[model samples]
Target: MDFSEKPVLTGDRTVLRPFTAEDADTMWEIVNDPEVVRFTFEPSTELTLDGLRSWYGVRTADPDRLDLAVTDRATGELVGEVVLYEWDPAARGCTFRTLVGPRGRGRGLGSEATRLIVGHAFERVGLHRVQLEVYADNARARRVYEKAGFMVEGVRREAALRGGAWVDGVLMAVLDHEWEARARTDATQVTGEPRLYTP
Candidate 1:
């Protein structure tokens, strides 16, 4: 659960890094965006500048969670955030989630950010499992999770109310072994490294 060291993760299309206090104004807009509100939180949720400032202001100090801003490398704007929280030390696991506003959507940035942090969880943090829940209707998110090797566990019926209707929540998880397999495949493909995966 050590969050004192925040690392900057980079991809061709996006960068996942810690936030600065000056990012509050932009992040406030992103966190309060209607799409972000509907998907990642209760629809009735709202935020104020000071509130968001305080929230982002303390991300670096939290001992039990990792919160990193998702920056679209193309535009150099902080489009959203990726988080790992609810630490279970006994199980060496955590829950994963993210937000990508209009600026970052439809470009595969979400999936890239997910892979970056989840890789960190396994390769750097020594986590055994990572899990997430997405509304059944969010096919995009489901696909993203799939690309990251997260297998759907089951359905949580009527798990949430969004847009005046109840939506099924799809529970998905990826164990360290699964991720290791994926990582090995990725490395083999990228660097033409010998694939003697014993995991």
Candidate 2:
């Protein structure tokens, strides 16, 4: 895992790149969105603008994590972030998390960002697995995770509370072998070649 050299990962619709303090403006929107706040964090949690600025500023210094801003490829506007953190070196894996602001939602940017970052993890970092947890009620995010090759392991029932209601968190993960197969499938769509038998 080479954290020293962060790379800009591009996809059809979105680009994932290292963070800049200027992107803090978008964080304001993301942290305040009802859906982002309810699903990603405790409903009562508050994010001060100054706090977010400091948080995003030091992302590059962390040697064990990767925090990249997700931006629209065409507009170059910051949408959200795709992060690989909480690293377990012995396991050769890390926790994956992402979110898209209102401006970037409902357009497949989230899914594409998932694929771009996950691809970098498995292919470049040699991680054995990448895992994430989505609230059971957040079906949209679960679907996106599923589409990106993450399979549900189990439910952490009543693991979180939102609006005074307990919500289950669905644990999902993608393994190295699974990523390899997914990569082949993605390539097949482009070249129409059955590369499954190559390895």
Model 1 CA lDDT for position 105: 89
Each candidate: RMSD: 2.6, 2.4
- Of candidate 2, the 10-residue stretch with the lowest lDDT total is 190-199
Backbone clash numbers for all candidates listed: 0, 0
lDDT by residue for model 1 over 60-148, one digit each (tens)? 88778999999988888888899999989899999999888888889989888999899888888899999999999988788999998
lDDT of 2 by residue, 55-170 (tens): 88888888889999999999999999999988898889899999889999999999999998998888888899999999999989999999999999999999987888999999
Q: What C-alpha lDDT, on a 0 to 100 scale, does residue 24 get in candidate 2? A: 84
TM-scores, each model vs. reference: 0.92, 0.94
**TM-score, cand. 2 vs. native:** 0.94
Model 1 misplacement above 4 A? 195-199
